[model samples]
Target: MNDTNSLEPVTAAAVYRAYNGGYFKTLVSPEQTGGSFALLEMVLPQGAEPPAHLHEKEDETFYVLDGTVSFRIGSKTYIAGPGETIFAPRLIAHEFRITSSQLHFITLLTPGSFWDYFMEFSTAADAVPVVKAPTELPPADFLMHLINRLNSQYGVKLV
Candidate 1:
């Protein structure tokens, strides 16, 4: 048997869009039971982001597929462009924005459960507006719920 067959692929077009944030597609999710990891493809238009947050229990990695992004990984802030990758150790505060209108990237979140958490939180009860164009950031409460959920359920803390 081929080891590759044990895993399934999550097409970029199938996943849902971000609510009042940006765009995202799950390349691999828990539904596939593909292991303890998950991958997501994201497109962040200019002026969009998830707010400052952290994942204390989960290790997240981001690899820029295209364009430029202003990323905040812990106390440092920098622009990561195509081919660059950023790693956020557990418990570190982090967030990012698409500085240019065409920023795309691939993110890997260890322990696939984060994918499930995001799907549930983003769909059932989110405070963002889901605006079609770039706009002001969402309120702190909006991000708090998301950050708190990740912290409580997945042990991810937003400092």
Candidate 2:
């Protein structure tokens, strides 16, 4: 049964690999329901990192599934290993890096619709021809475009 209903416990095996970077998958999103929450599984190979970004209208929570990850929430950073969890409230800048050999984790958003924005960005990232340096941020206009598109499509304004 799908996640919205049924007495059967949802299994991790049912999580679908997401389109962004082929490194993440989803167990549920707003697409599953009008629910205001989303959950994701992030697979970070050694040295992998997600560009630093923040949410203006949504809060994010991370629960480590395996290995160690360096999570940067605002100016503070910490190494979060398996069984560890981190939360970044709305409007706070955050980013992360896979510090250990391999890292896996589950990230949930306060509003499920945020997952729609994430998937959209991830899809754009996969389709984009330009390569981003490990430390480089996307141009402000590009980020703006992505955020705007997300706001329009998923009903989450990233401003």
Report the number of the highest-TM-score candidate.
Answer: 1
Note each model's CA RMSD in angstroms: 6.2, 6.9
lDDT of 2 by residue, 28-92 (tens): 77667676788887765654464676666679899998878887888999889889999988777
Q: After superposition, how far is residue 87 of candidate 1 from its true place, in Å?
A: 1.0
Model number with the top lDDT = 1
Q: Which stretches of candidate 2 lie over 4 Å from their true place?
A: 1-15, 18-20, 31-33, 121-159
* TM-scores for every candidate against the unseen true structure: 0.70, 0.64
Off by over 4 Å in 1: 1-14, 33-35, 123-131, 136-148
